[model samples]
Target: MHNAQPWRFRYHRGSRVFEIRADLERAMPHADPDARGLHIGCGAALLNLRVAAVHEGLHPETLLLPDPADRALVASVGLTGAAAADSGLGALYPAIRQRHSSRFPFDDREIPQPLREALGEAARAEGAALTFPSSWHLDEVLELARESEARNMTDPGGDTDLARWTRLDAASADTTDDGVPYDAFGPRKRGGKSPMRDLAGLREVAGRDAADFERNPQLALLSTPRDHPEDWLRAGQAVERVLLLATLEGLSSSLATQPVEWTDLRWALRDPVSGTGHVQLILRLGYGPEGPGTPRRPASDVLEVLP
Candidate 1:
């Protein structure tokens, strides 16, 4: 989440459809120049809406990149069909609020195999691939994250995106409608091998404590068949699906997007065995304290209904 809601929605009352569009003002020109992150985020929102609709006894049919000419129109979701809702999606309604990008360290204890399989299945159901890499592959991905982070910190222009979205003060955290608050920054990594980013970057928080994160983080990669606007949308939906399921399974998670954000390193992160071309997001999952919920704009602020 950023300092502001990155998407807006137009609800077509007559058709019972919600059309999502990117808010360019919230676009990160440096970090997300292509607006890929924006679309992914909206895609996640789309998935949430679907789950909510299912819980309300409706089926949500979504169309990604609904308008070829209007790139800003990311996706459109319409309620279709009657009851007989998707029980699985309806089950995830509670998770939507519980899930957050936990930056805290997880326990050294491993996640159960059954839970891991469930998460992979959730991703597949949304048309994306999630793979838990071997130890060697995990090492490579983490190294790349560190390198990417170093570059982002050292370069003068790299943090423009972060500067706009992160609120460091307690007052701002309490007042802001969006953006990650200081309380949710977790601890400065004094140690451990987790791939969680320091949203604070070089800025030091006076009382923010530091802690040791898990060395062997449960790392998974979400990927797609091809890299395109629609694929990113699908990847976004897949990400939210996996996250909701993980939340329901009593796990907290965070994203390691640095590796995937950098073009050079992202290519290297492909599964050498499968040679998958599209590596979407790096997911770190395990048992940890769930991150605090970041504030979101009320539906009124982000949504408009037309007769």
Candidate 2:
């Protein structure tokens, strides 16, 4: 999460433009070698900015990966003109604050059809696709998820990124405003894996149960046409958009990127005949009781005021 907010925004009072650029220092080599996560993180922030703009009664237009040489510069968002936020957008605004990654077991009830449609619409508006698989497809994907969990758990550095962000104790001096908090993380169910369980927070995050995790949970996927950094960012913005929509519908969701992060596994997800470029993330969603909120770095910390 920390890797994404590297750019600074400047408002040109006359032109009414907001310029987005990459912040190089926040980039992580080990976790995000190619800057995919970095772009995705920025893309999520960009979506937040767009939502905020609509909330303020304006249309936000974004230009992606504008500069060729300046690879760090991801997107430039400009407000087109004065416009009223739509009712649907207004409906989702409230969920921004309420939306969070829920790792605990969902109620086992399927999400309402209307809500699913709304979520799909949210992705379409942002130039991405959000798909909920059939039971058969879900079973296939779940096996991949299990494989991903096992792979990440076995990888030595996989846990490092998570541990860096997760705060085990509220009063602990190592507390960070970013990363998952212990309270928000559910127990690690034996013989099972949840998209929310990153495995790094196991002992630190209280109430992990191995048994409960073995039960199957609903699964979803986020896909994009290309696999470049720009796509990752766009996918991220869509990610935020869909997640917000889910929260508004009174549902919870978690993300699993391990499988998608690996190169070989990613290509396997694409249909050779259809030639879908790549799968950015695998999501788990359902009508679960909400989980606690994880820490978000303050706007002041992430939002840089340009000189």
Candidate 1 backbone overlaps, count: 1
List the candidates' TM-scores in order. Answer: 0.96, 0.87
Evaluate residue 259 in candidate 2 and report its C-alpha lDDT on the 0 to 100 scale.
71
Q: Write the per-residue lDDT of candidate 2 for residues 76-185, one digit (tens) a residue.
A: 87788864645355556677778777767766676778878888888878778888766666666666666767777776666676666556676742356655666665
lDDT of each: 0.85, 0.70
Q: Residue 7 deviation, candidate 2, in Å?
A: 5.7
User: What lDDT would candidate 2 get against the real structure?
Assistant: 0.70
lDDT of 1 by residue, 50-85 (tens): 898899988888788878999789989888886454
Task: Tell me how many clashing residue pairs each candidate has.
Answer: 1, 8
| Best of the candidates, TM-score | 1
